[model samples]
Target chain A: MALNIVVCVKNTPSSLSVELDPSGQPKTAGVLYAINPFDEYAVEEAVRIKEKNAGSTVTALALGPDADQTVLREAVSRGCDAGVLVTGTEVTGGDTLATSRVLAAAIRKLAAAQPVHLVLFGKSTNDSGAGSVGGQVAAWLDWPGVLSVKKIESIDEQAALLWRMMEDGIDKVKVGLPAAVCTVKEINEPRIPSLKGKMAAKKAVFTKWTASDLGLKPEDAGAPGSGARVARYTAPAKRGTGLRIAGGSAAQNAAQLVDTLIERKLI
Target chain B: MNPQGILVVALNQRGQASPATWELLGAGRALADAAKQPLFAVLPGGTAEQARELVERGADRVLWTAHPSLKEFNDEMHTQAVCAAAQQLSPARILLPGSVAGRSLACRLAVKLQAGLATDVSEFSPSGMVKRGAFGGNLTAEVEFKSPIQVMTVQAMAFPPAARQAGRAGEAAELAFAPAAARTEVISFSAEEAGEIDLGGAERIVSGGRGVGGPDGFKAVRDLAHALGAAVGASRAAVDSGWIPYRHQVGLTGRTVRPKLYVACGISGQIQHLAGMSNAANIVAINTDPECPMMQQATISVAADIFEFIPLVVAEIKKRKGVPVAA
Candidate 1:
């Protein structure tokens, strides 16, 4: 059977430069948002699978603010056959549970047109880094879900043999079709968008959906639908200015460091 | 189902609780106390020894199922087993250690229970809400659960292991679960090479970064690690440059390590990297730049060339340990 796949993407402020306002919320001013780094690997893996399986289609699905359209265009330029952006405050302001639920609903709506063989997500988002949505989406869809997938060793229409990153090492697992998987960084090296691909992306018009379009009520979609709320935001524990050991010969400084470590019983 | 009390769950490692599970127990005990609820522990694939250990580790009640199918992990069947446990107990809150399995299972379980959830939680605010890294670990969000049931997977090394009350006997009941056949089958598991330390639980880690010019630059870092019997870690820059495997990468996206001591060599200590090792008991930064973030946050900062400093540290530690120096 020809497989139909959906890869989810998120665009977030660069991890390297997030500054919080006094209210403990991310200062959105002047922050550059890019396709989450991990999702680049997801899109790459999806496109590769699409290439390997003839007649397969890869749809890039993103649930975020309209600004996330750029990531979808980026995905299309990379290799995705189509792009759909699900926007509105319902998902953008929600927690992982509500967010996963909305995405699962979108998948169901997508399935109404064509059977979705697989759903893909970056292992986690850069902003939250919870790594929960992928597995939760599987739960909502009642499909086999694999988390932290490192490799797809082999895949047929019926099932895919994949490797999951585990505590001690890796587990080789075989998951049936119609499953959801969260891809890790080790999956594949993403390709740069070709000039032609970029031009196509520029001309591509994306399909947009709202929570209401996905059949979710206002209360069941956004912060109102979320089970968890951020009661407050706090700064990370302040680490004291570290002590410096310098102005000595290499051996002497090394010896002093060793002595200090020994004194602290750190080694 | 009426939900009350705190439920602690951890994936078994060869029929025993993983080391981080005890830490979960500690956090659970504290949370349960603050919430004024009973503490419960569920071990779906646990043996009697692990059940006893959990009891000694302060689980007010232990639920275990030694289901054979669960002996080997089949995510579907194992998740079913935990769901069965939760269904039976209907605890108000569930806590798990942030192992790969725990995080995965926790999410699926949350969906099954229709629970509010959080992942990688590091602390609890004064009001009993969870505190977790957000905006790439630069800000902390104190999450409050609105759902009747809450599920969370906590970061490793964030809390101390529960103190074992030796010789204490507690009640453990077999959790009867008729598991559904899993759609996901396990073919095999390849263990990380023996003698190569896992950074997650390592007490000491020697990490390299951008200044480790190439793959060869890691040699000095490795030498220091070997002398100290420590795991080797790397910053994202080094890992991205293909100088080291991703397994050794430590940062927000990589493994979060809370070692007793962390030695950073040639690392610039980006905020992302600091997110992983900032909690270490002691941080020793060896870098050429005096004003770098890693140096500033380090417990001991040495502004020196890693190439020179690493060799000297290795020799000194080896001498202190009474080992012969290499020719």
Candidate 2:
């Protein structure tokens, strides 16, 4: 059977060079956006699995504003067969739960057209890094989900063997097919878009879906539906001025450090 | 409905309450006291001993549920158990540890309860505001729950564990709840051969980065840590290069450590790495590059080859302690 994979991607500020508005939200107006760094790993992993499996199709999906189309386009450029952009007022500014709900609804809609055998996501987005959406989506779909997956040992029609990174060590999990898998950076190196692939991505037709298109109401998704809101933003406290200890050589420096530690009784 | 209490979801490992559980109680106590609400603790598969320990640590009441299937963490079952407790208790807020298991379970519970969820929260206020690092610690944001019920996961080491008072006591009760059938099963759990040190409580840490060269390079790091009685740590680069195990990794994606003294050897200090150790009381950096971020932020910056510097430091420590160096 041909596998149908949906890779969820997010568009975030290109870098930490962001200006917070008076209300503490990142000012998005005219700011550069790129595919979330982690999501690129997910996209790469999906493309690899597609290359390995015959007749497999990878559909890239994103839930955000029109600027998020750039993320989907990047996915297509990296070898996704199709792209879907789910946007509108009801899908933006939502917390992870609300975002997962909208994405789950879109995945359901996609499954209606074609049975989805697998869903993929980055371990977490760079901006938020909550790393909860994939599991939330799996719960919404009633499917098993695995996080921080670094290796895919084997895959067949029924189940997939995966190696997940854990605090103590690696967990080798056997997740049944039609499950959600969140990829870590160690999984694979993302490829740059080829010239031909870029051209194809530019011409690719995107299926845009609104909240209503996915059978979701404004209250069921986005900021209105979000359970959490940012009340304020503040810069992290600055560390004390670092002291640069100098010495003539390594031994001298080491002695200075040891003497200081002894003086302060820090050791 | 009147806010009933602040509920803490305790985590367990090999039948004992994990350290994160105690830390959550510390934060929970403050939040509960400020809200003028009771503080309740629930363990999905915890034992009576663990429940009693929580009471000693400041829990007003403890609720525990246990089953053979619950012994190992199954997200589906854990979420169901916690949600069941939340539904019955009607807590205004729920606090969980932001560990791997906690984050996943917290997300599922938020969906099940349709509550506001925050992850990696480091600070909490009685007025329902939480502070968390965003953009890899470059910025911090204060968030609030729009819904009646709120859920959040506290970062490890962000709060000290509650003091265990000898005479402190509270009520303990068994939570009667049934868990759903699990969709996934753990075939086996294999731990890495290297004994993992608990970095959360380590007073000092010696961490190496990619500039440490390779696995062999960590020998010096280990020797220095052994001399200083500090835990050995690694940056993401070193860990990703397979030079060290992930358990020893110190960074945003790894363990967050707040030791009194942090000695970084050969680490260039990416922002992600800083996010984990920036809070350390005193940071000492040894690197060849004078202008690396770590060197700039370190309380004491040593410009030298770590391979050369670590040995001298270790020898100096040994000599000062009256231990004869090996010939």
For every model shown, what is its TM-score relative to the native structure? Answer: 0.97, 0.94
For each candidate, how many residue pairs have backbone atoms clashing (under 3 Å)?
0, 0
RMSD values for the candidates in order, in angstroms, are: 1.7, 2.2
Tens digits of per-residue lDDT for model 2, A1-267: 578899999988877656788777787788778889888888998888899999999999999888688888899999999999999987888988899999999999999998898899998877777788998898788788887788888876688888877655577778887888888777877999998779889999899999999999889898888899777777787775476777677789989989988887878
Candidate 1 lDDT, B224-312, residue by residue in tens: 89888899999999999999988898987788888988999999988889877888888999999999888888889999998888899
Question: What lDDT tens digits, residue by residue, belong to model 2 across residues B127-243?
Answer: 678988777777887888888888898887789889888668798889887766776666667776564456765788999999899999999999999999988999999988999
Q: What is the DockQ of each candidate?
A: 0.80, 0.67
Off by over 4 Å in 1: none
Clashing pairs for model 1 are: none
The residue-by-residue lDDT of candidate 1 on A220-251, one tens digit each, is: 77898888988767777778877899888999
* Highest DockQ against the true fold, candidate: 1
Tell me the deviation in Å of residue A78 in model 1: 0.9
- In model 2 chain B, the worst 10-residue window by lDDT is B192-201
